[model samples]
Target: MQLINYQMQRFWQYGGFNPDLYLFIPLSQTRYVTRGYNQVSQTWSPVLKKHSNVSEALFRVRATKAQSTLSRAQRKRNLKDAFSLSHCIQGKNIAIIDDVITTGSTMDAAAQTCLDAGAAKVWAFATSLTPLLGK
Candidate 1:
């Protein structure tokens, strides 16, 4: 968590990614029930709360196959309309945080959802990025 916090701080300080609100990618109900907590939210909430508002801006509409287990096409298909906005974000700049990014389908879907809901701009941040492998 310390390393992630450092990187996130650098992203804001050096990368100049200031946002009106911070949003963490929500876990599906099924996954949340099994895991007991959304690690991404748990880890970053306190850190972000001090500087910016942290919001659960979206919810998973349905569960899909794990991204790591899917091909690129399948990854895109799995998240289609999978998230629903939970609150108003009109004209707000948002930062969406996720634990890991692979093909970026998840972030794209979330950002698109926010955009469709009238958010001014959306930026994505992740603790790690997975190298793409043969689908």
Candidate 2:
């Protein structure tokens, strides 16, 4: 997430300044609400405060499986309405963050949710994209 947050800051600085920027995160497998060492969040807290334009990085939804073993069609089917956004992202440019991106179906579903919630543009930034199984 550090990489994504840094990229977002650079985009905001060098790229056209969009009025609103939101980070969308898919919730964990379970809702235990435990706070572990979130490196990305720790790095982003100060940066977000520095720029008030970052409205939120809220986890308004959850995803089912980890998307490692599901077939292509099953992955798509597994994510149908499996996620929902609680916040209004309409007309905003959102950046969805995940550790990796293989087929992009998971990210696609998540981004679709954001768009359906009114997001104008959804850009994905990830640390890596491995085509191997269990990615």
Candidate 3:
């Protein structure tokens, strides 16, 4: 997770990274220690350059059951309004990059936040998206 965050922070060096993209990082509601991950401290040059475009959101309005533990409907309700946009994302193609995507409710909530914030469109990219395999 730490590595992922670092890479995300460094993405600014790549031409693909831009200010119009709002990078919202979901906060861990529980205090449980991650197996091996750390929040980035020093802002890399790329991160600094991307600062104008990137931002963080600490939504999670209320702590409910984790995605794995909740039913799809429950997950949707739990994550509803769980995030807030930090900047005006209107008329922008906001790409939400998360380490994983499960039921997609969380992503929906994130996208909803951007939409509510006036974003014209929302694109999501995840390191791993869990599909309902072998159904």
Candidate 4:
């Protein structure tokens, strides 16, 4: 959590701003049931201020194969139509938080969902990034 806070501070300093809303990447119902809580929200909730509410506007409509087990192309294909927005996000600048970024397909798909729902802009943040070795 501290590391996320420090990184957020640095990002804000460099970008000269913070997001209007924070959105945690939603896990599928099956995954959520098994995990009990969203790791992204659980990790960053402590550092987020009251003004920046964690929005549950987005949700996974269907389950897909885990990104870790797929190639980049498969990852992108697997997330197709996987997410849906619960409400209008018109003019909101959103930051989608995830615990780790593998191929980034998951976050990309989430951001697209927000944009489709009328968000002004969307940004993706992860605690760590895993490099795609050869592709």
TM-score order of candidates, top first: 1, 4, 2, 3
The residue-by-residue lDDT of candidate 2 on 1-135, one tens digit each, is: 567567767877898745466463545535335545444444555546665655444453454775778777777877777667656766887766655677877788878888888888887766678884643
Local distance difference test, candidate 3: 0.61
TM-score of 2: 0.69
For residues 26-128, what per-residue lDDT tens digits would candidate 4 score against the true structure?
A: 8889989998998888888887765456788888999988787778899999999999988888998898989899888999999988888888989888878
TM-score of each: 0.90, 0.69, 0.63, 0.90
Candidate 3 segments exceeding 4 Å error: 1-19, 29-52, 132-135
Clashing pairs in 3: 19-53, 90-118, 91-120
What's the residue-level lDDT of 91 in candidate 1? 99
Query: For every candidate structure, what is the RMSD over all alpha carbons to the true structure, in angstroms?
Result: 1.6, 3.6, 5.3, 1.8
Per-prediction tally of clashes: 0, 1, 3, 0
Candidate 1: what lDDT? 0.88
* Clashing residue pairs, backbone N/CA/C < 3 A, model 1: none
Off by over 4 Å in 2: 1-6, 17-19, 29-49, 53-63
- Write one digit per residue (lDDT tens) for candidate 3, span 1-135: 465456666765564655466464465556224533313212222334535655554245555566776677788888766677655666877767565687788888888888778777777656667864332
**Stretch of 10 with least lDDT, candidate 3:** 36-45
Better model by lDDT: candidate 2 vs candidate 3: 2
Q: Which ten residues in a row have the lowest lDDT in candidate 4?
A: 46-55
What residue pairs are clashing in model 2?
A: 90-118
Model 3 TM-score, 2 decimals = 0.63
